[model samples]
Target: MVRVTSMAMASLLSHITSLSLPLKPHLFLFSHSPKPTRTLSFSTPAISQNPDRNVPSSFNEDIGPYLSCSMPHNNRRLKVAVLLSGGVDSSVALRLLHAAGHSCTAFYLKIWFQEGFENFWSECPWEEDLNYAKAVCNQVDVPLEVVHLTDEYWENVVSYIIEQYRCGRTPNPDILCNTRIKFGVFIDAISSMEFDFVASGHYAKVVHPSGDQIHKDSALELSQDTVKDQTYFLSHLSQDQLKRLIFPLGCLSKDKVRKLAMEFDLPNKERKDSQGICFLGKIRFSDFIGRHIGEKEGVILEAETGDFLGKHRGFWFYTIGQRQGLRLPGGPWYVVEKDVKNNVVFVSRNYFSVDKRRRLFHVASLKWLQGLPPNQMSQLQCKVRHGPGFCNCTIIIEHGEDGNEDVAVVHLSEDDQGLAAGQFVAFYQGRTCLGSGVILESWDDQGFSVCAKALENARMEDKSLLGKPVKIKVKPETVATESCQLDGMVLSNQRPCKLST
Candidate 1:
């Protein structure tokens, strides 16, 4: 084994940090790795090819007229606290707010990380973030505030994220950071700071209140930057958080924001956008996870026959639909199910087969943005992850005592591959994002979970259990199809609430 020093580690991190577009899309929403100067994160798409065109940065073509639908777009300069990640997006937001004559203060939130996991999960560069943040603040003559939320972040987001993964789920830390940290702890921190509203470079728009409804009740409109629109991450933000917050670069694209940073002569204009977990810096998912969960040896069995196909680093190291790192023989395989307690990974070559692909699943802890959306089952578009384009889905929810739908069963029009537990599902009607929920389980039953768990008693050292007879259980049949109401209803029901183009 080679000995690694902090100097060696720093150099490795610097090299790895420059690698943009991490393998994990959900965590790298804001890839703000530290550079010579600080950079702000707007969760923008890859830099556009053409940087010259200052595209119309509005919900629609007419921004002024659009805001006029509810409230005025312009108002007197107000003291705003901007969440600056020391990147181009947030930096530009800060400059714009400062230029517009709003009293601005840049805040950099710090989160928890493994003490010495350099090769995989990176250490948070709070010091460098602060330095570049200061550079921009000094240039604009604005004050910078760095709130160390390591304890709270670990307590609320980090622990929950790790726990979810350990329990065989792929949790999205970005969503949690928005709900529990950025909009949660940070919002409460500034409650007495006398700041009018907290702003960030997130590519999301806050639709001003409708009618006499002033601040807190305003709706969240999808940003004009559709490709980079982070309404998915911001979907869990409460109405009160929306009221006290502002997204400065809501209408601008990533490339356009970069251009503005250049035009403004911002100090950290060249700083690469951070490809990281909210504030946790860009890290290798497996390495970061293993640091907390530790690695355990497990068997990778064939999904259909329960044959001992191969071995995995750990069940926690793999996820549903993952094709890489199997290190097995012959051909590629996909993880179908994870037996967390038994430490077994179920894989199959037939990823698109009848027994594998799924179109429907159950989700617990359902939350509806703007109150409960249509109690009746309605057909709407939903995205499984942070990417453009959506699949048609019929929403099935069961209401709780408070008249809130605590449990939801999403019925997809077609089977989708790569569905993993613990991922966030966002509901959308065209450009307007409705809300999101956590995927509890899929309706899959191919002896994937049960067969894998019974391996020890079956004596699998010689791999005899590979072809053992196992009965497959289907979700609808096991959970009662009558309750899901999948029998007698039409799914072509579209909501009349189509958003403006």
Candidate 2:
């Protein structure tokens, strides 16, 4: 609905035109949207309220000293390419890099989106964002490059998003997209551009020990910004990837980044942080998903009796633990289960009622981000979603349906209601992110995925698609009548025919 004028769009285009090697236009199918310049209000938290003050920001902190102590001394400038999204965190990173005299180049990535979807997903325009990044680069005197990843984004990122939702998993496209695109595609681009390293404004850190033996092959060390830290999402990145990565904003808390952005006079000093899909702007999850996937209205049910309660807008619109928007007439109710096949969402009068205890869900497609062997993963702590505190649960890794390996179920020693199918179940050891895997299924069954207490302290395996196919039997007579090969596998009484040789 919101449109940017041609003049404004052209102004943003000038930077693109200025590149020595012209960018391929198809890479950027993104159109500009209209947004207002914001007057920001920054409220400093009370000293007691700041749980992340321990995170180091300056060159004097523990992280800085650790890095300084580790590597061979070099006076040469660190050539770092930052994935600038034109936000406060990134702006601060640029300022920090520039101040440190690092040979910093800002690469502004442009991924295409549906026209009106921008307003629905985010408030800022992609063109305006690119322009802000250019302005900062021009002011900071660092070269900025713009790369449009439209097609690759759709194929790699968007396609995965649709598939994840279709299969009933709440996939974190940002993390996957970051792993595959920003670090994957964008990093490859920088290799051609001759940059020494890549950086971003992500609120997570990577560190190495102080010694001659560079921990280039070592795991990424967790930063102190646990509240603002994004290490969980970055868990999928490998040691090889971390070898050339930098996080200038990782050491700083969100507040310090804002303060530094203000002190640096960066244009996006007060820009609000993006909340939803990586590039897609402020659109609601269900609405944005609706643009790509069909929104089929489903039945709402009572958790105990399975009685029809009411109709739901769409199952895609809700997650497992959601409680606020059920619109029920009875006393307050919570969604206890979703029957994606029956098109139903089940609710309960009391969320923690004793009856809710009997039913449990199963998890599948569990991946270890670090690709840790099955042994180390069994010992780590797991977080089912972003905001919830880490739960002390045992990890179970086993082969599952169709030759795919998955996480069967995370048995919470204590029952926590509102478990959803498509969310992440990240594993951690203390502050270090061991790795994370997509939650496949969850529920209590005999021999549920939990490792035995003696084996609970074991590690995780890194094999992909570990489940065997479910074999079904088709009517034997039909196969013979149809002249189909009788040797094919049968699952749930449905035999898949193999064509006769």
Candidate 3:
């Protein structure tokens, strides 16, 4: 309904560039790239276009099996609150639930940038999203409510994100958005309405306890679409939250959802999937951080040797395992560590060095969906980020001073370069998501803490060296590719080492 033209988009980007704080060159390049358009067309049998018409037999035959397991056991029509974004997945989800004979109310959350952040708000097409959401709800005669949770989002989610970044930790805001707002505050907001359940387009499964298993807690499982599965984001949800939530697209793949969208003839059937952190929308993350935290010039140094390499806007602008924006000659460099106190970032060519084992990490503030830790903690699958990949992990429960289970020491079967403090590690046993915990710090296999202690020592040494001016002529050194033997295999394809004097 509110179409943003290509000219308008380009103009908006130009305005961003005209701001007092210019974005990084690479970020500017990324912003200038053309956005992809979705042009899918299907010739499937026509389903009834009328909202009042009964679902076609063909529709039932196609999607019936998937819904069979998720539908109400009593076969009773229920009042459902559906979280509708203007995306195709959510639109198709609303249609599926409508066909399932449930009374549905659509809610479009107005949690975009609040006032005073008009610049960011203008960049995000939330008005278009809301318009599309309204169109989808109107198609099915479902009443749409615009919930203003901007204050709550800023207080709970946005504030936490800023604090985490300020503390030099990479936090996953999407995971918090699902846990704190979508399921947390939204549920409380509509509690007085006494809706039977809340539903969404998330690609994750929630299996409610039934029959004799009614005594057991609701289980969160992976979606049929593994690649699109969103359990990582939903991992922090409590058992109560899972019990009251419904994910219609859990059993459906992305391709199947697109087909359903065509069959339903929904207004947003051709809408492309939204990307990046939900709140930021089209705004570059660097620009967002720059606006909030601002920038301070910091020095980049080699991790093994304290040789200066280059300068960065700020240490907070980069993250571990990052290989971009370093603008240094010689070869590719990876961010290995950060000296938060000194505002310094450390890099290395041999990021995957055997000496720098990232297999072990400590996680704090555990949230178990089942109300308790899993019985089988030794053999579990864990994800450090939102993706299909899962690393086999074992948990060593650490007790607090009061003898309560306080921390979880997770040992990954393999090393993860991207492991960062404040990131959530969602654990899974088979299809069921046990829950997740925040990574406190990481360590090497030798039991040496790699993140905190190592960085602290570097920070202290740098502090002593600060304010003492010394001019030293630096010479470039050519080092051969470093190789290591792992599991009886030699890894000799490592990047050529770049040592600075």
Model 3: per-residue Cα lDDT at residue 289:
83
TM-scores of the candidates in the order shown? 0.74, 0.69, 0.79
Q: How does residue 76 of candidate 3 score in lDDT?
A: 76
Candidate rank order under TM-score: 3, 1, 2
Q: What ranges in model 3 sit over 4 Å off?
A: 1-63, 211-213, 403-405, 442-501
Candidate 3 TM-score to native? 0.79
Give the count of colliding residue pairs in each prediction.
16, 54, 0
Which should have the higher lDDT, number 1 or number 3? 3
State which candidate has the highest lDDT: 3
Answer with 1 or 3, whichever has the higher TM-score.
3
lDDT sort, best first: 3, 1, 2
Q: After superposition, how far is residue 439 of candidate 1 from its true place, in Å?
A: 0.5
lDDT of 1 by residue, 20-60 (tens): 22234322222224223212121111222433223224312
Which prediction has the highest TM-score against the true structure? Answer: 3
For model 2, the local distance difference test gives 0.53
lDDT of 3 by residue, 249-304 (tens): 88889999998888777778888887677788777777888889999877777776
